[model samples]
Target chain A: MNIYFFKISTLLYFLATMVYSVYLILLKDDLLRWASRTVLLGFVIHTLAFLSRYVEAGYTPVTNLHESLSFFAWMIIGVLLIAGLRYRIKMLGSFLTPIALILMLFALALPKEILPLAPVLRSFWHPFHVIFAFLGNAFFTLAFCCGVMYLIQEHQLKSKRMGAIGKRLPSLKVLDDLNYYSLKFGFPLLTLGIITGAVWAEYAWGRYWGWDPKETWSLITWFLYAALLHQRLTVGWRGRKAALMAILGFIAVLFTFLGVNLLLPGLHAYSNW
Target chain B: MKEKLNLGLKLNMEIIVIGLNHKTAPINIRERLAFQDSEIEEALRRIRSIPSIRETMILSTCNRVEIYATSKDIEKAVQELKQFLSEIHRFPLERFERNLYLLIGEEAVRHIFRVASSLDSMVVGEPQILGQIKEAYQRANESKASGVILHRLLHRAFHVAKRVRTETKISNHAVSVSSVAVELAQRIFGTLEDRVVFLVGAGEMIELAARHLVSGGVKKILVTNRTYERALTLAREFQGEAFPFGEMSVGLKKADIVISATNSPEPILTSEQMIRVMKERKHRPIFFIDIADPRDIEPEVGDLENVYLYNIDDLQKVALENLKDREKEAERAEGIVREEVERFVRWYQSLEVTPTIVALRKKFEEIRVRELEKMLSLHPELTEKERKSLEAMTSAIINKILHEPITHLKEKDEEAMADFYIDALQTLFQLPQSSEVAKEEEDARI
Candidate 1:
């Protein structure tokens, strides 16, 4: 919680991700391995930093958008590492690590001068709402990675620029399968997050759903991913088309988390940094 | 100079390739050499009977017949294979030797890689050769003729072939002998929609030839098989007619191009039969291609005017020409194979030194233990905790002492000093030495 270690780890994570991105371009799998190790090391340091913050603050770091987003990013890294380990996809960390580093940077940039969580945020629903939202978003983020890989691979196959990494990348079929399953896993968690957030709102603010910017954007994001899963299963849409739709849904999730929280006024505006 | 390590594993044994092809001794030789899927065990038995053959696998495709084997005595293996061929085909080996080409060591490795990658295939970059190689390996594996070295070499060759197909443009286009026939049809007839293709049999080769013609815009395909129902079904796919065996000559006259593949005891289409068709067409050149065993088209038809009688051998020549065009890409693929081969060989070499290194470490530990026991006897008055600490200190000291030497021995460059170190260590310790250990150490450096 020296916060300095987290900052340094975040910087290292950024550097590692960048190195891995270049490694992919250059086909340096050894360097990619090094980058993976570095990011995993950075995650360890980042975890220590977060634990220190939890001890200092004496509660779960989900009081405001800044704390929640920081935790959101930390959980995303955990999610990514787990997914990467399970799938044995090394290059994916190159993309997702940058997202984690950026989110952490944004966390550091938040006004740390403010006091702890307000009295209104002190509820059991608060932890559930934030935890579910962050985890659901993490799954969606992985779906996003699969989608991006799918599109790149599909385009390469179509235009036939299929160079080294293009050849090394998994087939469009595999990427589509990853995207489909990621969304399938993500949708219900997102629904739970939304339901919890709604209940928490009703308990604290005397309202269940206010159609606030964050709430509205979250619903839109939910609907998009929902439509994606629906269209894939019922309509038999898959491959590049499904990948593109999942990507679009993640973009909506991004807007709900970042863009709406920052750019628009809402009932949940107090949480914005 | 590196020490003489057990470089035998890395050593490329001669690939004793003894089998007839389209170019070599004709269909008679090739068919005689061809082993059926079930009869491969018998073929392996006959192959193993050949002197000095360490490993063997028969890859008999329609275009070429090849035997891949590892042999220390290349000449003896070749002679044995030659005798086997003579015994099987009942033809003198001297007649086919001129057409048979022998590749040893690196050339053999390169040839196998090319064959597996489809570069040596009748169709450049065709995927069928990979499957054929896999089938050959499977048969060899099941029969227990292939050894560990061959198993690794072949699997690595397959991996290399896959890498080439994925990383290069080697397999981007069709260049099969049948594909050339298709190409020629497209060039001459403009479109297959107006042209008629008369397929003379229900054989797979003839069906493939007909498929090429059909894809080339052949409007009508008249099929004449021994079985009229089978011919009718084939013709129906292309919206054409199925004529009876008796009406094959009539079907030939109707067909602008004829592709004949049959297993007849005698020539099905004679010069006299073709002469009548030539007179009916007023000397219109009928492109007749015979892709068959014993040849469905009469060889004497070449004497007749306005008759283009081309056989499987001739088509193979065209296929070879197409193969030549891809030699540049094949060279690039060869470079990849060479790199992978070296890497695999190096990895195998490293595996050899590991056991030796472990043994050497054990010897050092034995000496360390003896020294520790002597020290404990000298300091018997030391306290229990003090004695325990001394043991830890001594083990750490031994580890520190051995670390540098062990590290140096494990270095990639250690093969250069392998002989000197092994000899010096053997002399200093009065240890029993083996040439295999030194040879293994030398192989690891490369």
Candidate 2:
């Protein structure tokens, strides 16, 4: 049942992506409403799928490549829906829906069997760790979208070519503010995620500190975002510089989430496939 | 009966437009003819009193003075309107006669639609003409100078204008230098609310640019000039703060947007000064608009990481590009106007008494012939004379039943009352509507 709901949600997300693409080209308000509504519906069904999977697997489902990737996509869409309520940036979906769809497709291609929970993963802190980590990554995803928009708008202004694409984008100040908001929220969630992982590691492996690949990469990603936040607060590194830094930090996030898991060997390499 | 109905359609009242625009007349002549707001009611009343004119509206702006009216005699109406313009302005008819244009029938309708859509504007896609036209229309309506025809025509014109606005990109770009400057400021700063605008000198162009910024919601204005007294005078006019020339760097550090139009021979704001200000302001993106002749801000300042600089030539280039874009979009806008004109003309024709009466007669005749044939066929023993008598009797009864309503519909002297009667008759008898009339007209024309 959970798989069926997941498949249905993936299809709905695909529909949303197509709608958003049309909205971007036509710049129609009705199409944007349709796109946002479709995303909301898909998010609802996706949440049900997650809950159903938790019931079926008797555990939090972030234990493998497939489950974690799907969870990340779900969190991204959830964050986008929440952000949509706060900001009138309709074009954000045009940038975000594709990313979410690609993540869903990647998850769909991986293994789907409900394996038994490993002994090391049977701790109370595991679910909190995964949820905090994915939520932080979701916020960073929003920052990355805002960063890209800021660069495009800034370039359009600097070059003095206020064309259709430039007119459709939100102003530079709005994008920069969104980027700052994402950093302010994402950095703390990320810190808590790391702390929770450390506490869970001590319970599971009898050690709080480990030179694991995921751990080291996560630390590097955390430091990048921390530096960006600090500079944004003190030196007021904003506009183009802040946009570029946000982009760079998200790349670090992607590497820590995917690259380290796939390419490096570690105790946290639960995706045996 | 068919011939009479066709004649009625031919004698339908025509819409006539007569005017002189910027293209046709010089500013002196236009000024002479333009109607002030207080004088518009009197002008409309006098124009409506013309014997041949039925309903009227006057649109008077700096660029053009046009009178829109419906009349039975187009030529007489046109002559009277011209004579009224000459007499009211105390100008000789021969002086501006060559500048006048006379448009009648479908041409007049198309002209009004084009004007309302801004396709006929001095700047093709400027939005001011529509508001001016709406205000003129309101004044005419309030004075009761416009009746059914002008009312319907103006409303349709408004609809066409709205369609052109949304369906085309005609009005999306800012095509003036000051507007372009404001647009760039908005793109950099999002909302201009609480943003500070610093003026380097009290030049006309700089003052115009500052006025546009203030209207765009910039709350604070700072003025600086080589002479403190001049700066103080300009600042007081803007309800802002003035600074001495030596203190410009302080204003620059606090400002989000700066407009420099100094008469200095050399650049006053170099890259070094801007770099220090950027540090002091913490790199919160600042925009510089340099409209000065010798350029008050150095060109290298534009290359700074978060600094956006546009000079007079750069602003002009963007405005020119936007104007070209509007011209391209104007073609699409004209197509929309053409489509709407055809639609409005169709609706206008459908309200004619001839078509409705003709359709009603045709419907009654068809029903009478069908019933008579059924009765005659039922009695195969009936004589030829008997069948003819029955047909005549049915025709007489049908004509008696239709006579009162058709006469009342034709007797309506008010166009609005006539329209209501036609609409009620069409609904009561389920008459074939506008499409058939439009098709028949198209066939007749071909």
Candidate 3:
């Protein structure tokens, strides 16, 4: 029953994501609202399904790629729902729903593969490291959305199209502010995630830092976002420049999450479900 | 009253516009005819009592004084307007009415739109009038004097003006009509550099015209007003020379362009006066513009060869020609206005559906409660706590079921589906249409 609900919820998220993408192009606020509401509803159902899994499993519920990715998507949605409500930027859902859906779809495609943890894996700091790290990446993802909008708005303003969408989009100043704070919040959490990962690595493999592709790429993502925040705050280079940097950082995050696991063999890759 | 279906059931409604404009009256005449801001309330009271006048707006500007009104008896409103003008100025009614030109209905709406958009301005497509109209609308809105029809009309007029500015070439080339006149002068003379321009008055319009000419590279400006001090002040500001009124002929001879704007009622320059000046300049083509009312320059001066004399009327004709170019872009402007109008109308219509929705929700909740109560009464074996739990379960189920429909109704208010649903709810519940008001009052009491 739990599996069926998750599957249905994820499917609706995918459908809603597609509708939102179409709505961005269609430029209808009403259609966009429907898409966002649908996505939010899916998120709520997905959260319930995840809670049910946790109830049955009697742990933090992260054992393999399937569970981890599903949890990651859920965390992203939770952040989005909270931020969206607080900020009243319903438009962000159009950017985020697709990303959440894609991650969850990947989670679903790999079957139920909750591996029993080794005695070494069962530690106090393990869940905090993984969850906070993923949550930090969630913040970075939101920054990426704001960044993309900033670039589009800047381009449209330069071209003097000044369309309804151009007008409706948040100002460059607001987008810059969002990017700045998202990074400010995410970077420290990421540093903690990396630090905790390091501690976990030292405990499990007798090394605090490994230049593994995932770790290397995650560091690279960290540096890019850090540079963006520094440039924005120190040099006051914002708008399109900051946005491009954010986009690059988000791409690096994607590579760290998916690419390192799938293409490059890594210790984190435990997904032969 | 015969119904005029073509005018949207306004056959008995006569659109009477009684006013004095720059062309028909002098500044003294126009100022006397004008209504001060403080006097508008009393004027509105007086005008509304004048037998058949239904709606009225007093538009007072420096260049124009107009009373726009709809009346069952057109003569009554017209007579009142004339009498008010006479009483205010201590002039005869016959004298005041002679200077007023009346336009009705279609012409009136078009005129107001054009005036608000600056198309009907003394200098066509001048942007100042647009701001002035906005000020007038704001004042009217503040007073709560404007009704539904006037509100829509004024709102539409403002939208139309914005449309004209955005989608048309009217505001693209020239910002002011005076500047356009300068542009024409530049076209005629090839360049204003090393040319002497004579400003015959130190008035604001004359100052603006002189400034435009100076910016266009006129080498020298000769200022000659009736008052020597005024001419000297204008000359000192523009770094030009001041010629006394006695030496007007000398200034005319040296000037390649002569711009006259004064408050004088009599002809300042006659054909005889110009013929003498022309001989001294050896028939040099002098561009003459008399922006003053009541014939500052004799009309016959325009008939003189090598003298390009343009009075306010002639200048307006040029403006009309320019307006023809603006008319080409009117459809594009109307498209913008129509789109904005639809957007505002949709938002307004949505406001109407909100009460109906609230009523529907109340009716649904009532049904849910009644059904829950009946179900609990039938279950005798259930403990009080168990019955309470059942009630909670049933209530949650009811709320969850209603959620999608209520959300759908709120979000899809634009679709007219809400109206149908509202009507259905009213029919289904056999609820009174007045239930929303009563419910609100009842809630307030609670």
Best by TM-score: 2
Candidate 2 CAPRI assessment class: high
Report iRMS (Å) of candidate 1: 20.6
Per-residue lDDT of model 3, residues B316-380, tens digit only: 65556556655655556555555544443332232234554555566767887898788777877
lDDT of 1: 0.72
Better by DockQ, candidate 3 or 1: 1
Error in Å for residue B429 of model 3: 23
Candidate 1: stretches off by over 4 Å: A1-49, A64-66, A78-95, A108-115, A149-188, A191-195, A198-212, A219-245, A265-273, B1-27, B34-89, B102-329, B336-446
Best by lDDT: 2
DockQ value for model 3: 0.01
lDDT of 2: 0.87
A best-first ranking of the candidates according to their DockQ comes to 2, 1, 3
Using TM-score as the yardstick, the better of models 1 and 2 is: 2
Candidate 2, residue A229: lDDT? 88
DockQ comparisons of all candidates to the true complex: 0.02, 0.82, 0.01
Off by over 4 Å in 2: B1-9, B37-42, B88-91, B138-144, B348-354, B362-397, B406-430, B433-446
- The TM-score of candidate 2 is 0.90
TM-score of 1: 0.50
Report, for every candidate in turn, its global Cα lDDT versus the true structure. 0.72, 0.87, 0.71
